[model samples]
Target: MNDKLDLQSTDITAMNIDKIAVLFPNCVTETAEGKKIDFDLLKQELSTEIVEGNKERYRLEWPGKREAIVTANIPTTKTLRPVREDSVDFDTTENIYIEGDNLEVLKLLQESYLNKIKMIYIDPPYNTGNDFVYKDNFAKSGGEELFESGQIDEENRKLSPNPKTDGRYHSDWLSNIYPVLKLSRNLLKDDGVIFISIDDNEVHNLRKICDEIFGESNFIGCITWKHTQQSKNDERFLSRQSNYNLVYSKNILITKNFKFNRTEEDNKNYSNPDDDPKGFWRSGDVRSPNLRQTLKFQIIAPNGNIINPPDNGWRWSEEVLKNKIQSKEIIFKNDNSGIIRKIYLSEQEGRTPENLWDGNVFGTTRIANSELKELFGDNVPFDTPKPTGLIQKMAELFRTENDFTVVDFYSGSATTAHAVMKLNAEDDGNRKYIMVQLPEASDEKTEAYKAGYKNICEIGKERIRRASNKIKEEKIDKAKKDGLFSEFKDEQDYGFRVYRLDSSNMQDVYYKPQDYNQGTLDLFADNVKEGRTAEDLLTQIMLDWGLPLSLPIERKTISGKEVYSVAGDSLYCCFDDGIDEAFAKEIAKEKPLRIVFRDKGFKDDTAKENVKQLLKQLSAGSEMKVL
Candidate 1:
């Protein structure tokens, strides 16, 4: 039998069980689904004390917690189909835009993007009663009310509003987000970080789950973003003008320091008053942040005047302080009142990000609305859009690399894509982005719907296109105005490849051949779906092989058969019918690292054996697979 493609998302649950089996074989037991982790045995192995039945533990629990966990581990048969008509650059662009349920999208990305993303930013439903929350099947027990409420999409995705009156309001919201977040965690690099925006409605519950998911030690900090200076005086009590941004890292040890790009204002305090050879310097506080008895000793100035340490003590140790004085880093005031530590501008890495972000610096909701108004004109399409500045600031705080990858699952209005392009245009970097959004229908009465934008995904895709054009035009205008048009050729990527999640390209018989008897074998001649194209098969094959969907694809005809070359020989695919020895030899001569073919494409059994032997002789290292 030829090698068949395993067309499904990664089996994360099985992988985890295997990992545990290596460490604790006794904790791994057989179940109906093969090998599974025995939680009772695992607990006993992890704890020093005796583990009993139904023991109480500290955890964030809801009605459907177990279901939520199970949902995250279950692999999906879904695949991402490329949409060339909706895409900006279908073949060459490294960026991606997927229209689908983010939970399924995240699961599909586990193998291809595991530990690869540099940053992630999400603005999920705040569960503010009015906002619609994702109504996962496991998130709620019954679906009659949801169906009657008329919130299910054409694809059967439930989108129900979580009113405060509902008894399972909090529990439903928890179940909805828990699985998506769990899957998202697997895609982050060791030094990667995720920033989630929320409001007062569910911030408490959000933090509890985040602490449980990312671990308490990995909790970075919560930023209080003052979105609007004006207060809502009509509120029952005090006005709520700010929202919270909860930041977390994949590994705290890998990414401990978060900083933002230093601005002109940030560097204004630094000056070369004494013309120090090191460079412009600013006075830094010598006091320690926490109490340290060993660093509380007094220091003798060069003039023999004793200088007392601050209340908490010095920032550096006595030996380090002596080194600093010798290096002239610590200087005494002319009045001998206190010591001033000279922090050189040249030595400063970047401005340390603050927990409190002001509206003027970050962005306000009003600013975000204005941005949408400018892009879409009088009839804005989306509501509650986040300004590009806010997302850009998060990337800067993470100290994003020039070629870093950013993902936004809840990509409302595609602001994250807009920000990535904006940052690249400003710095001439080649950053990439992936924006995944659900195709939630727009209300008929809404202006967006009236403007022919049928769903939220339409608005998001149009937003990115409009934003990309605007950014490119602005860059050209500035370059021309400054008389540097010829030399100012920006090579940054301002395009994205569009993909929509759908059912696998393969037919049922391809996955379950054992179920079909010899009598029904003739019906399964063509394993692929009827409407599927060559590109669709190649895309799914790439995903099944753990290849990124954004990789460059080149198509060419060899020996009268159309073949796809992915990333220039990283992978070669030929789903065409009628494969023969000549075609196989022609393909193998290219020395492709991996090759795939259609099993039924060969002329006969003898022909298939000849092609296989030819490939082995021509390209010994090329891994061959069949569909």
Candidate 2:
């Protein structure tokens, strides 16, 4: 029995929600925005998850998936070593080229660049039968990696081909990629996005992982890019000519702001036939998609000919039709067989980008290979590299400002890097890039090895060098012809700093000082490795301080001791052999925001304290430390 009460004017939605809450109070919840209900909680209240004998309604799983999760969370003690000889602009460039394992590199960068990267575009191995999967070995120390860099022979490489004959073909590929994606998601800003390229071999699995990593709601779209122009006769059945670029955003609840401007051909469709004041106009069919008996009527054309309504019906009601006709917006053809509604060109916001990126609009594999071959003087080692135009199209949709940063961990042949530089040259933007590549050794039997390239990273570095020089040269030629380079002369920054992942500069004592016995305690004095240079220690210290490796550095002598000033005195390091109070006062006089002095540089413990106290006295706002 229920108590009867007088009914009142109320909201149907609130009443229905109250009824649900009365029956199941657990389903109701209050969100930060307002009172709301969690659908997942409601499902739990209903116990629908176990409706079919405890089976999951939907999920994607595979063997070793748990291991992948564990691997992503595992901590590492690695540091990046600055390689000046291998860098284009070792001290000034804002771009970075890292030669090492991408997963380890991403892990080390987590603190320094967390939630900072704007866009990422990676062309990873598609897990095809012949593709190579990274054999993630967490046991290997960073020192081991440094020693084995660029010498990844067939037997020693931490990679193996995943042929279909292998029992865990798909599983191995999944494990190889799962950790990298998980780590990469941590590096994206709130509005950041990642574009992953894959073929049919693993597109489905990749989508599942991406959905889990970047919530399903953040899925932007799966773009179908035409990779090849012609049909392949070698295919057994369907001739596949396209691949997918799965895009996901860190947060898509925000506005997309994606706009694809109409081409000249599209604008040609509009014409000012009557020379209207609102500019050119185009005629469209004046029919609605929905039909109703009220809209089913006959019309009389301007020529006195009767015309019946379309099957769908007129787009406007009787009153609306009369208003349009009075305004002269409803135009009749010369023959008067039909009617049309005029659409002004001013209201158009260009065409929206579709998922299908035709090969003609962007370049195909044939064109890409030809371009690469011509650029490299007839040696295109890569089988399929994305054309610069294709990447530029998507790059513009995301970031176009000077502060924008694009990351490409799997930067094969550095096409994305080339595209970034080209976009900067075209738009005069100062975009930064981070390119990471494994020094995967080339087999002696391959043409790349015979062409004087020892590893894949060599090819990628050379490509960036050639592309940067060419872009600069093209800009100079154009500026010279147009005579408009008053400000553009010194604005181009087409250089990158090269850093390789290696062991920490701090010797074993830095990790656990208490574990050293009397015999090993003597070795702990000046714990940095023997061969490590001042630059190497400076690089590690920068990482520990969460500073970007791309910051500009300046070297000068202070009181007869060499000091490296990073980012215009944002951080200063004096890794010299000796440090007296006189030298410390000289460094303090410069007033660096953050400064580090070598512990061994001091004559004694009292000398270190005197220098630290004098620095705090000289510049109270500065942070002073001794390593």
Candidate 3:
């Protein structure tokens, strides 16, 4: 099979070609009768480079355990219930108010929502001289001592700023931020972007860390926003009035696709003084250096005056000029101003945006705070919040109506969401926001706490409520004055849905006889009161079944008892009370794929046996189990 057939020159007439073809029929090829086959042409076409194939590689697994096992001396179990009913207005609106550790919330969101966010704007703690420090204790010993010593106090939390004198100041800050930034990057889509608001305290470090996470190629330019009108505490040098917004993109090419919206002022620049049939007109130079190289010519005005063209050349050639003169497409602005040409707006191309951001178009922080105060009366809890106009401008630049998702992880006072709502109110855009904030207790020493605010989350929620109310009020007042909404009565235009963060609903219910005692019953009772309804326990069972958590749940009264069924097509359960024969027969008649019942809720062993038999006879495809 590996033998070489022929190498040196061979005489085809001397050899019996037909006999040789028979000997190696598959390898031989014959051309049309009496036509010569060009072997050289075939060889030239078939010649190719031989490249080495890539090798198959295997990853080595670590021999040690991937996670550590530490004895938790104190109880750290928490109960998290859905706050949809409590908040009432949440989910129907576009805003979100999350209360918990942002890190944990971000992790929980990894599965259901990776690569789904459009934009993420975070204003994390600046790590100033007296700024609050977050204590990260992922793994610790003496949990009881830590809990009892008020280390994890719900009311009075710990916040020790990293002093410059501390040896691990930078290390501590990096440790606090690395995990969050890593997770936040996962939430961004391939075309998503991030805007980080930071001061001089850690802007440089933040950029380096972001580069490592989002790749240096994705680094967008930093925007310098004029944050203050006047700067104080100037001894020698001038006080800085601007703060930096570090921008980066998931992909630079994707971000470049974002278009800037033109304002009415920009549109007014184009005028149709000549009344050219092309809608609007503007003046443009009639010379070019690159595109019209061959168009250089001297122009003789109507007054018989000769005019020299630009150094480069005229924008059109003599042939093109003769064609325009015949068509009357070219017009001189007036008899005076050096014969300026008219360029119609319809003929003009769209302008690309410049990098420089104007403070007048957006606004300063003083104006932002004043606006906030006007909306929420004097002495608002939030000290510094971005103006709604600033965020609205960003939205106009990057987002379109009903097309983008905006996220603000460092949602101080929920200003980002407020801005999104305001923009949507104007243009009816469906931009959604996901806000994450640590439940940091408000400082008693600060005026915010003295105003009766408990934590930053409380202040954020209240701000959203007040902003929504104010927007509605303004809309109503405008509608009344315009006589457009006199018959409407209610003219509210803004609403929001709020969600809090917590642990997974799954809990191991299996316990040995020896482990069932008063303490276990007490724990179970506490879980029941914490809004852990029968439906909640059944959801835990569904998790154990490896079913999707978003399965549809239906409640039905069977045999004078409530039963929760998931998917309504399979997995029916009666967890409320004693299961009766009539209910079992009815469930069997429905013919679900799987049926479950509470083991302790059956009237007798006969009732359970009757259910199993009925399912086997009438619905042979069903499987029954007890919890």
Candidate 4:
């Protein structure tokens, strides 16, 4: 009996070895160092490490979930561009307003937009006592409950502050921000940069988190902006008047290509009075210890009187001085007190921007708010909106034209989108913006909501509307006055396509014949609504397929019904019993990889056979399913 058991065990061991060999073709290898390399062992070791790493990550993780649906359908309402009556259309204008939790939106954008963004600027909640916490609730059946509530009212809304007294105060903030930062990093190009606005409360935490997310090597300098000019007397301790903007890049090595733009103000200081024919030039001190070592030098005046140098010696070496004099580069002052040389603006290169940004050129929040009030009415909805000048300065430093896409996920009042629009309009450039804001209700107790605003998203949409209207009106007025209008029509110029987060449109319809009821039939009928084209359903199908969200779609009419195709591969269709042999043949001619159709679309048994035959003829590898 023991000998028989040993034989059986040997057979089992041999069978296991054969299975392993089939699973891992390169399991055994001989290294050049005369050592045996077991790929199977190496893979097992790596898998163990991965499992342990995942366990550690989960151990430190906070409990929360995203409240947004990742889908493929780009919101048609969000792409509102002014239609031209006569002028030829060119590029697609993108000023996107996504109505969803930004966390899911970031994930949805990961595939098509990885390493494509130029700059990301976020003005998240400051974690102050009044700031609303992002309570993610995904357990609800109908998509995101908070977002599905549409426009929230002040009475039903909850905007609690993240007080320090709370046990999970810091953890909550970290949980809310970690996934977002990690996802946003994927959207940044190699040289892409991000600027985060924060207060003293979470600056240290933000720095540590950013270092971990963006890599410590990618950290740039932190900029301190004077948020408030006045120091409050009500505070017992030192009053805080500044906020920090932490900057980081995807890769500092790639960021070396970035250059600061010289403003018009900086260029205005240069002049060309001497006409040295060297273009523009700027003056520099001519004296240096290595070049000019003499303690003093003598200068001969036009009147033949000898002028002694002051405490400082000559600006250049004796040889250089002789060369300048010979070339007539040096000039004598008319007063005979000293000799001054002319500097040409064309002769000098541009200067680098300094760390300190003055409020004059890049206006402060006060100026920005005042401008908003001027454009809209006296009562602005939100406070502390960043100025277009400031964003423009940053944009100039990072990118140009449509070369990069900019995102502001924590877009308060849509200021970053407004700035992007204004910048593009000024330069006729095609820089795109993706703005995401929660539909949190405004506080009726505060001055803003009491003035008739309901929620934060309402304010954002209104701002975009007003800004578009103003830009269109100005352009029309200018065109009319200049007589440059040759058939241009101003047809609602500025608008963004609006998309709200929602679940997959597919319904679970695998009902048994015995269990079929009126409710199931009603759901099926509702799913196949009339006037809704197949393209709409196909878009939702693509989302369910986990395909690229930005896939190009095309539509064609077959048997008087529209059949939608995505990426020339997936076909989605639905129609009443009119789908016949000819229709199936035409659809199969496209050679789709997958075909989806409504169960009731087939006319009879003959129609199903025709579909099978067409698939065999044109698309042999095609898979078919019924919704």
Candidate 5:
């Protein structure tokens, strides 16, 4: 009787089919499942220079490649249920923390966050044989050892080992990350970027896969981050002290130039010794970097001393050099030996970011361990956690926008969240973070479990909480020391909303309505699952409606019926029973842009039709949907 809400994640396969149908309508045909692309016919249509029949091509592939692709395209009925009890500032915070499998979580986010994220930074598993635990069809038959060892469970959602003894050691890791990367690409804006951390063991393979996913042309160079300075004497050859962060942009043409904020150390070279109009200037080389005959010239100083050009050439031509000298941009030494070009501090943008990062600027592993120790008091929650400074530096490279979003799927210890908050507090920028981490269980014998942290998500959430307080205390201490305590305004967001991925709220009968008969209707009266709260249904509805979960929500009573208003009437929802024409008319007077209701709320068919017609007449532009 009413338009039902599509309570499912975005169907990527359908979208691909629609795209193909637009280009090749003749190759699209209706099937029992739905509209499907006729691949054979489509291939024939593009047969001009098309490779087929196992022709060799440049690609990174492995077993189950097709299955991985299918996994990315498949739609999910799963949804993120709000966990307000575990969240901080649940009603107002823009930051989010989701606990779930990254792959499924990425699928659920396809619609609401498509092309919305400004940047992504993930330190995924380096796959040193024992780190891989993602269970998928990539090595189903070869996981006998893992199955016998009790690594995999009935739901296939637990951590399963991908041992090196297995034949598909690298293949399993590839398959696990491939679909996640594909789904992540959809969430990046046109000018967005992603930084992936890896080690020597899988850096080569990671780069190849990233090149394929983000396009070879969009490769933005990898940074070798030195995480430690100490050398291990027990190494087989040499002690490795550095890892890599492969950078890529969604589109290279629109990506901004990477740079870091200029620090006090970077500006120490500039001075106003000459007291020129420019604030501060540093001497720059006036010689050309490469040989050029036209630039080879001589210049006369104010003391009638002619100085010969450098071996290669002068940086500027004769006339240009004369103009620069006239403008006093070029000056001679006290002895009139050579000319010096003045590089003013005011003219510089920032320090150019290098491919090699080291020292405390990027934070060492020792410092990271110490940071955890300081927060947790010797009982460190995680081993080898990344430093907040490291992620902060990576975020600084994005000099374009300040009010951007950063996502970290492998948010071990929530370092990315802490870094974002720290950066925001430092500069008063509006940067938000979305952390997605699988709740890998902590061993009972480990310190984390002894500290009452049952899983990785628990550690991540607690870290964020403690880090938030620590950052706030530091800010307060600095403000008081500077005698600016009263004037200081802490605008940084030190809170995040928590959501856990779970099965859909809809019952099995909701998806299979045709399977029920008139006699079976009594057993399946309510389509929604039992114990699902109104907030749970609202969350799913927002996702299905392609609305962000960060929007403001308020509950109000209109004509004795509770109505939920989102973002000031951008959406309105009421799942209560006993809805009649009076409530519909009253809610329609609010003129909501979108509204929803429970179909069973209506008393009879006539009442449902009457309420629907009244809403249409009152709220002409409002879209009405039902659950």
Candidate 6:
């Protein structure tokens, strides 16, 4: 089986491989050692589509492009380790903060999050010469270097700064970004969209890859945002004042249509001046820019004067205009120049978010910096954190429903998390956010380190805490003023569960199960590694079973031993030592949809054999699993 999928998920790659094998049986031969796919044979089979020997086909080439390709496909025995101390509300919250290499996190998320994410937004390094990029060397993981990036050998594992002085400056950045994006695409829902914030440094390069990965047809509009108003006098050429969000949908056809969340400012345009019982009303343009000779008709003014069609003619036909006039839905200008149509506020769903955004609507960089200083007691740690307002706009644009998941692999100062909370408070949305940030060490000389923030992840988590509290206080004031205290509940989650990508709780022998036998297992005694708790093992199992880690957990003593129930008995688990058969039988009585047990926790073969049979009989159709 491909490592990405649990028994629950259908591995698309595997499915495709099977489909290909059905058409060409000879191309399905396995490698001599590992039963891996023979890509050479597959390429030979698909000779028509295959381009080789310096053909004139267009392709995006970089020094390390092949290595990046290999990086995403390489398998790992890694798992997410629960860090309850670092978390705010570890058990009850839906939001999660993952501290690790994003590439690995992307891999781990494949099964549980596949076709589940509603939207994604990331602001990655822009290849600004001094910026650092992740280098994934597959050879270091003991696999043959199937791909090559001229930068590294099979030894080192570290992030290096891609200096502009290097010959392969752009190539290095492409190598860094390509694989992560390819892997991230697997997690997106069919209608899911991704918004990447980038500047001139890598916007063109990013766009090229996005077009390739998401397909040119699925490309959404590139939104240009005015990030700042002040001119940088130090620039030698034209001063940079804006950034862009390259948007793309996983599959555009599934979206039905694009929409932006209706904002208060958008609704404020309507007023009930001469209300005809349609609530608040605003004038809609009756004339469109589309030319249609059929729609070019004259209309009689309220004063019985003739009014001519607009430059491009009318948006409605003469019949529709006559019906509007009869229904009292048309408004005439007091100056007797033109007529307008009524657009009732109650009928409006949302306005289309235009491609251009000014600084005033979404707060500028200056405002973001000021916000940081205020939250951090005058200590501005991050250099160019985006304003929450800006990210909120993007979130609202892609959010077609009230509840959805948003993942940000490059969550710098947790501004995106702040935006999620703010939007939720404003509209009572149940949006969940997942923030992944590498624990990039903070510079010792910087104010962040001086303020006791040891790494970027620390600063980001702290920002979320501060932002959450501030939003809560503001909401309390609003509720008090509106006299809606009784209607509001204080139970909403403003906290997150935290997990770190760490080595698996299982020993090396467990991953390399082929090397171990029944006698070897006796010699090893305990399969789980030392210094790992039952909870840690439980978390790894949860992920392996394709269960979400954010589900609420309930621990109880059944038959005088510990057992865990997740999300109200949807899944049951017990990883305790010397677990009794009676306890297993008791758990099976609940008949949860899924159940898990430690493979070695049983007293002996008889104990294990008895419960295995009892569980099968007691809980038919349940997904029974063992660690």
On TM-score, the leading prediction is 1
C-alpha lDDT (0 to 100) for residue 184 of candidate 5: 95
Q: Estimate each model's TM-score.
A: 0.86, 0.81, 0.66, 0.65, 0.85, 0.80
Kindly give the number of clashing pairs for every candidate.
0, 0, 3, 18, 0, 0
TM-score of decoy 5: 0.85
Which lDDT tens digits does candidate 5 get at residues 212-285? 99999999999999999898899999899999999999999998888787989999999999899978999999
Report how far off residue 602 is in candidate 3 (Å): 9.0
Deviation (Å) of 411 in candidate 2: 0.8
TM-score of 6: 0.80
Question: Ten-residue segment with the worst summed lDDT in candidate 6?
Answer: 145-154
Candidate scoring better on lDDT of 1 and 3: 1
Query: Cα lDDT of all candidates, in order?
Result: 0.86, 0.81, 0.65, 0.65, 0.86, 0.81
> lDDT of candidate 3?
0.65
| Colliding pairs, model 5 | none
Residue-level lDDT for 21 in candidate 2: 76
Per-residue alpha-carbon lDDT of candidate 3 for residues 296-330, written as tens digits (9 for 90 to 100): 67767667666667777877887886566566566
Clash pairs detected, candidate 2: none
Better of 3 and 6 by lDDT: 6
Indicate the TM-score of model 4: 0.65
lDDT value, residue 366 of candidate 6: 94
Runs off by more than 4 Å, candidate 3 = 1-80, 84-86, 90-94, 136-158, 233-236, 284-354, 486-497, 503-531, 534-627
Better of 2 and 5 by lDDT: 5
Error of 2 at 333 (Å): 7.8
